[model samples]
Target: MNLLHANDRRGEYPASYYTASATPLAPFPMLKGQVETDICVVGAGYTGLSAALHLAEAGFRVVVLEAHRVGFGASGRNGGQVGSGQRLEQDQLEGMVGRTRARALWDMGEEAKTLVKDLIARHAMPVTFRPGIAHACYSQGEADHAKVMAEKLARDYDYDLVDPLPEGLIGSTAFKGGDIDRGAGHIHPLNYAIGLALAAVAAGVVIHERSEVHSISEGARQVVRTGEGQVVCDHVVLAGNGYLGRLEGRVAARVMPINNFIIATEPLGDLARTVLAEPVAACDTKFVVNYWRLSDDNRLLFGGGESYGYRFPDIVKTVRKPMLEIYPQLRDVKIDHAWGGTLAITMNRLPCFLHPRPGLWSVSGYSGHGVAMATLAGKLMAQAIGGQTGGFDLMASLPQARFPGGAALRWPLLVAAMTWYSLRDRLGL
Candidate 1:
């Protein structure tokens, strides 16, 4: 069965705590017939919606087609951390792409953070946009390395938002030390995505739900075909991410899909202090990252573990195992909700922006650092459509590697790789 249909009800969000908290919008009609637009955007998640909103603002008619509800995929269900910089750090990025282009990418990374904060402010989104992300380390050596990376950012890039984690800041006893980035932040991602959809409608962009695109035929004008209808437009953007499947050959090569799960405990009230002393989000050094923060209701919203398979494992047991290790005190806390999301990953953990054909673009594989980068991608796409390629071109210039064994064996290979990483994480290798 198709994972999108098997895993989710068409036009509905998952049974996530995010769904419980989000202010639901009225469902848009499904595409029943042919339509024409200046741009056709597949997937109404952050990238597609943001691109539609900005493109509409630029006086282009845009239509966004979502296979499910807005934010139904990783866009709505992610860890919610608004990370700074690219998925690869500046030091590593400099080595890969050289200083000049790395400098440009760094500037864009900063722009991404600003873009999120600006979108929240300008649109007056209800999602709480809070500052600070603490990177917890498992050992003193890792802590020192974290601190050095923070310092390196300030020294090399003249960006000074990160610092060593303060004493007694995080309540986890297993952590040696950590660093916090003032530039980084978190939000109720579902609400933010819904807010984007609302804003896109207000800006006159059309959105259709339950619009699973079958294929795109490019000619003088691009024709995006759905089961029951179609969209004819001058340009088409493939922003489907993990749910896009293998529709586009180039994106499928670099963007491999995987599942990540999360759990939210019952309101901890004053006991929230036993987890996070502050409101900042926290992510650990594990390859399969343990990311958590306190919800507005004072519950611990923790996300951990990853699966390369199409189906999700036991969501509660999968995430709670790592969560308990971090906060053993919460052993008895009630798990209010549990859910899994799908996100695309690239070889180098950087986003893949592809122009597979003229007038057609594909952007995906944000890895885990998508909240800010994905939003920035929309703006960059809008800029590119308007004859500006400075930022988008730089990002597209970043290289991406294909899965080694083509289609059939990619999942097994990634599973093996992830198994080795999980072993190292267990033994602290």
Candidate 2:
């Protein structure tokens, strides 16, 4: 089976609210002949697109080759929750690395949010920059944990605005109470990626869609060969996340592509107020997180299903039960769109950026924090290629362990582990 096209038919981007609202762009012409550039970036998602934009702004002759259309991957089809910090909590990260480096990573997360906002304003992209991402907890214990985290971030980190919400105020059936992270917010992810492409192209970056990079060879210069043409450049950026295949074995092994699904219900109208009572993106604290928010048009967009195999489940109704378990009031809601996309997840829940070779670089495995992490990663990659490797070294210091089994066996192992986690979530463990 043509897995890519089969998954594409699985409804990841089939007539959703995002697709309906996006400002469609003319198709980018595919690469047809040999080209030379100072830098050749693969994948046109957020990371590749952002890196291209920054490199062009730095006056590098950059060429971006994409396997599919721009924003056609997870960058365009994500939950749109631009969260702060890494997927792992601050304390966990600090424990893995020293406090000094951990703090720097935290700071980068903040910078990523700023970069996104700046890009949005600079491009004048059509996106709803709404505020207030209230993280919901399943129990009072988690809420208490959030409070402690808030205090630590405020005192030691010189960061504030992460306020703990008392249980009395968190009347949602899904959560008791949690922290309101002011730094966190939501966006139209597709619009953001497309906007970055627009800005990148405007800054003179050449982007060729449907030009899949099939092979690469390294020497004084790197050769990126696509199906239709080849690109010879001084530097190469491997920004293809889960779909990148085995382009760079080290980075690819560090991150396994897992499929996460979302379903958009028909418009809720006044019922939305009864459900959330406000316009705030929310996610529970379970290992397999349940995240949901109201669309601009009031349809509830809930994302919380995982499949180990590349293909999504035959019936997406399996996701509805879990979604309703969180928001029981939505038991009768009609699901209009059910789709899934692959996300790169790592062992420690932290994104990994590696310089596998002297002239070749890769940054992937954002876990579930791609919205902000991937955006910043692209910036750091630009710096790395421009002879400033400080930021890259700092980010690359994050702990990384090989998946328990090799590529073929890793998925089954992860599935077994996640099954246990799902059971724990059900048992309130």
Candidate 3:
């Protein structure tokens, strides 16, 4: 099934809290005839929008083709946490790549966070960048490890934005302890995406919504075919992430799609303070992580539960179980909205950045950490297209392995693995 149309209505945003609160953009026209550009960016999420904006500013003609509305996928539907570092921790990265390259990745990760904030400031986006994300730990051992990692970051990386939270985060007694990263933060994800699209438009990037790319004929100049029209461009960026399907077999083999659900509770009024004494986001150390933060009007925006299949599970039922686990006091809270989105993941959880063919670039598989990294990925791709390939090359140099059974069997394999891990989480292993 086409994930783009499987769970959601065509040309409509999910009934998400972000959607309800965000300033809406008028829909762009669909591709109706042949169009030519310097670059054709497929998928108008953070990655495509960021790349298009940067390339347009650099004086390249750009066209962004979206299957649905801009930010209609995970970009708008995520938990909104702009995390620090790569999806893998710095130590893990050091083990995978060398210390020198690991440090460079760390710098890039830091730059990603800065880039998100800079985009917001530069564009004057209608979004607030709230600071601090607490990494809540379930066990004391896990808590100790977090403290150690924080220290390592300070000592080795000269980054001291993390602080130990021995009493746990978000006033939750279930967590033994944790560490808070002040440098990393959260935002209204959909609004940030809308902001990126606006910036891209202002920079002369043409966006065509509901223009799902059906195929690409590659050569010196590539032809990207949509339902109604086509785009012939010198370069093509595959930024569709989870909804990309098998548009490119190589990327599909490396990047597996998965579904995650989030729910918003009714405005808690004064009780919001009890849920989160401070307005910071917190995520626990579960195999299926539970993340939450207070919305602008004080509604609890909780994201949890995982689905392996293309169709979404009953989102409110799936997510509320975990939400209650984290905040049992919210047992009686009324759910205002619930939705799910597809996001891609690699075997190692590092983003897969590949120049699969000449004039064709694929960037996806951010695992659960794409908000900042994907934005940076876009900028790096634009830079590479402009003859400055250093940043993009560094990211593409990271090893990304294909799924053991390729695209066909990846879902079942991932389901089995995730089931095992989730069982361990339940058993407190």
Candidate 4:
């Protein structure tokens, strides 16, 4: 099943808390007949929209094609944690690529975070940026590791935004200890995405909602075709992420799409203090991680649970089991919204940035760290397309191993491996 249409209506955002709260943009006209542009970007999520906006500001004619409304995919429905560092930590990065390149990667991660904040401020977008993300450790060993990582980041990188919490994260006894990173934070994810879309439009980028790309014919000029129309452009950027499907084989080989669910509770009012003493977001050390933060209206927006298939499971029930595990006090609270979104992951959990062919670029497999990295990916792509390739080249050089078993059997293989890891999480192994 096409994940774009598997669990959702055509051209409609999921009935998410984000959709209920934020204002939506007037729909852009669908692509009809033919159009031409300097760059044709598929998918209107963070990566596509950011790339379009940057390229447009640089005076390039850009067109963004979206299968649904803007922010309709994972970009709108995630846990809203704008985290620091790459998907893998600095130590692991150092071991994988040398210390010099690892430090460069760390610097790029910091740049990604700064890009998000700067974009919001520069555009004066309606999104609110809240600071602090607490890492909740479930065991003493995990807590000690957190402390060590924090110290290593400080000593090696000369960056100090983490503080160890030996007693545990505030407002929950579920964790043995943790650490808070003031440099990392959260935001209204959907609003942030919509804001980027609006900024892209303001920069003279044309966006077509409901313009799902079916295929791309590459040559001296690339042709991106949709059901209703096509775009003949100088460059093609495959920014579709999980919803990208089989548009490019190279991206599909390394990036596997997976489903994750999130639920939002009714406004907690005074009881909100009992869930999070401060306004910081929190994520735990579970194989299938549990991430959460209090919404502006005092509702707990918690995300957990996993589904390997294209079809989403009962989102509320799937996520509630883990939500209650963290905050049983919320047992009686009403769940206002439950939703699932597809995000792509790679074998090594690092993003897959590929220049599969000349004038063709694909960026995905953020491995659940896309909020910041995806945005930066777009900017880097735009820079590369404009003849500056330093940042883009560094990211593209990162190792991206293809999934075993190719397309046909990768799903079943991933299911088996993920089930084992999740079982270990349950057995505390």
What's the count of clashing pairs in each model shown? Answer: 0, 0, 0, 0
Clashes of 4: 0
TM-score on alpha carbons, each prediction: 0.98, 0.96, 0.99, 0.99
State, as a TM-score between 0 and 1, how close model 3 is to the true structure: 0.99
User: What TM-score does model 4 achieve against the real structure?
Assistant: 0.99
lDDT of 4 by residue, 174-259 (tens): 78898999999999988999999999999999999999999999888999999999999999988999999888998999999999
Comparison by lDDT, 1 against 2, better one: 1
lDDT of each: 0.90, 0.83, 0.93, 0.92
Q: What is the clash tally of candidate 1? A: 0
What is the C-alpha local distance difference test score of candidate 2? 0.83
lDDT of 3 by residue, 258-353 (tens): 999999999999889878878999899998889999998999999998998988889999999888877788899999999999998898999999
Task: Tell me which of candidates 2 and 4 scores higher on lDDT.
Answer: 4
List CA RMSD, all candidates.
1.0, 1.9, 0.9, 1.0
* Model 2 steric clash pairs: none
Tell me the spans in candidate 4 whose CA falls farther than 4 Å from its real position.
Answer: 166-169
lDDT of 2 at 392: 87
Q: Which model is ahead, 1 or 4, in terms of lDDT?
A: 4
| Per-residue accuracy of model 2 over 166-228 as CA lDDT, tens digit each | 444333677777888877899988888888899999999999987888899987888999878
